[model samples]
Target chain A: MPQITYIEASGQSTTVNVPEGWSLMQGATANGVEGILGECGGSCACATCHCYVDEPWLAKLSAPTEGELEMLENTASERKANSRLACQIKATAALDGMVVHLPESQE
Target chain B: MPMFRFDPYSPLVDADPFPAYKTLRDEHPCFWSEEAGMWILSRYHDIVAAGNDWQTYSSARGNLMTELPGRAGATLGTTDPPRHDRLRGLIQQAFMKRNIESMGDNIRDIARQAAAELKGRKQIEFISDFSSKFTVRVLFAVLGLPMGDEQTVRDKAVLMVQSDPKTRAKGPEHIAAYNWMQDYAAKVIAERRANPTGDMISQFSLAEIDGDKLDEREVLLTTTTLIMAGIESLGGFMSMFALNMVDFTDARRQCVANPALLADAMEESLRYNTSAQRFRRSLQRDVELHGQTMKAGDFVCLAYGAGNRDERQFADPDKYDITRKPRGHLGFGGGVHACLGMAIARLAVRVAFDEFHQVMPEYLRVQEKLDWMPSSTFRSPLKLELSIK
Candidate 1:
């Protein structure tokens, strides 16, 4: 199991075992993480499932797509250099110990 | 009441049914038929009267259509005042005219994009490819949701609206759509809370008037209501309207010649072949309408389409004349609980017509057509094949 540490909106951190091929958004939402809202069901239409990648994982994951970037611009949270739509970041075996910070709100 | 067995989606329903509408208007101000099983008000005067008399005709009894068991009543269209007033107020503030107008460029831009994808196609289905694509784009813009998973959400939502006997039983698609939308709303609420902005959802979450706000059910219901209303009305609307333009080239040419004529086209279409068919309401008190006593708890159908065609109100009612200066048409409804999102829906549909006229004049030359799913209380054309060939 690839371990992923999700830093929730309230600054609480928990490590969950994310099987490869599952998107980070699905992993966090299914685990009842409470903050990541995949409103568009990983379609990238909604920027609700937004997060900032930890240092090591930023270089490991693929770059954000144009659609995701456009959606991110509408997020209530501040856009960061590492801002990534969680739906776009697929979990892979190489991403063990990966961490991402949840945005302040999904409302 | 004169019974011609007419419903808009019925195959026998002609393009012009003014004679029947006249008979209905003359014979039945508030007539009850055992066959239809509900009292229907078919005259323009009675229709407007019913809408204005919300005190007697409460929406809380539910709209003209029966829900799929667990659910009852409409979110905005079927509810009466007081609570309805508050809900509409909140919704109007969020879905203000300025916001809908701001989306005009985005609406036209989307139509342009869809036109690009459809540039070379010939003899194509207009509804799925053109109308829905264009309609949903504007819908999402108005919804303030992102544009991905558009098809999935639409498909799921459609299933959720079905009320067939099979659907009344445990149905996977119907259940999934409802669950998905609820989940979607919750997710949107969370995101908006985390990152507040000027968007409608953010506005809804933060909005307060006299320190009052919506409860959780009100929030969820309102959000889903807006989404479904836009989705159902627009997709079905453009399909039928496209077919009409295809069949009536003169009207098409007129609209093409004058962008302003499209507004008339929109109104005439709503009058002629309504996308929104009927909204039902139950009587709150024993009321006397047209000399017939309708007791409290009786549901009545306010037939907007029928009233629009009533000869006494509209001269040459069934001629499909866009220049009729349509007035008192219940298409967007009337009185207090009228659609708060009327501006948005009208703008989206008209933009579709205007943009299509500008980009592709031959848009009406359709190839084949598809049927929208049927409902007891509504009529929506599902697909229209456009002939780009």
Candidate 2:
């Protein structure tokens, strides 16, 4: 299990262990963390689960797909270079202790 | 010349479009339909690309052929980002997945009563008796409408999306239906505003975006859109789910034996036979694809049904196997304008399946004659006769 840290916009942090193959959105949502909507049920069809990846782990993650990128542009929050839909990021052992920042609002 | 002559208006194609979709994906990935007056993209890659490329392929024109271009801010589905973002942001909280999940019990209860009423019947009309009734009940619950008026509201909702030849020619009838819906919504909005009932409609009345609440016209249009979008396709989907159950005995058996597999089976049915066959998108600029140049203002049909069955995306595309775990299917569509009522749709299907299986797990298709509702986009039987065995 890889421990994932979800930091809210107000700087509240909570850590949870997510099994491999489960998405970070699933991890945060299942653990009852606020700010990640996952409205499309992790289909990447809705960009409600937008989050900003910390600089240290940004390079390790694959580039956002064209669909995800287009959807990211529709996020309620401003899009940064490290912004990604948490549903598109699968948890892996190498990503243990990774930090993700949630936007203030997903709508 | 296009490899396949595809006429979406033809009854034959509406009855079973998978064959035509296969032809389009295999021979002409970017085939142009003269009858529809739009370019049809069938392959999964092309369909996904066109849906995501909001700049080149625009929905601001309208997603339906009956609609004219440039009515961008009128509806959530018709507009692009910035505007779409602001409008959706105001009401998105009401339709969130968690909130929909909380309504599962009520949905299941509606399904249970509808299914129970069919007891001791030799032949049951699935659409009117079960699917439509169940769907309208859920719609009423979600919309905070009076349950006693379900039948009349259901009829109006149907006519709002009616695209049959006779109905299409009768323009006033269509306008009358639209007015009835808007008028009904206006009454509901007024009542909710006068007295905060805490229903979804009331929530819509109170929801404020950037210190401004949705205006009267926006409220009515948004409410009417939700009702129209929720009823027809969902009713059709439930009918199709029942059809799939009888068509595939082994798959159905596996689902009934293990309740967990029911969700996967429902998803498989959606992929195998999607209710929404096609949606239109206009070109924002001149673009070339498959040796053809499509200029701005040109309309194209994104064939989601064909894209779901693309061989490049799914192995053994024609097979309906529940174990396949069909993910990333374009059943609910893709990109920004993806179906807003998807959570409601999924909840309706799940609860209906659960309640139906609990009461009558075994059923037989009694009617050999089947006729699909004639529409350019949607596909479902007008009536389905089933016998509980």
Model 1 C-alpha lDDT per residue in residues B1-389, reported as the tens digit of each score: 54445343333232333454565677666777443456778886577657656787777766635443323444655556666655555656555444567788888788878867766665667767777777667777655677798887777666666544333232565567777887787887787788887777777766766666766766766667666766776676676677778778889889888878887787778778776666677888898877899888887878777887877667787798887756445666555555566666677778777777666776545434345565545566555666642
Worst 10 residues of 2 chain B by lDDT: B64-73
Candidate No. with top DockQ? 2
**Candidate 1 Cα outliers beyond 4 Å, as residue runs:** A1-107, B1-23, B33-36, B68-74, B165-176, B363-372
lDDT for every model? 0.68, 0.79
Instruction: Score every model by TM-score.
Output: 0.71, 0.80
- Number of clashing residue pairs in every model? 28, 0
Error of 1 at B352 (Å): 2.0
TM-score of chain A of each: 0.95, 0.97
Best-matching candidate per lDDT: 2
lDDT by residue for model 2 (B230-262), tens:
788898888888899888989888878887888
* Real A-B contacts recovered, model 1: 0.00
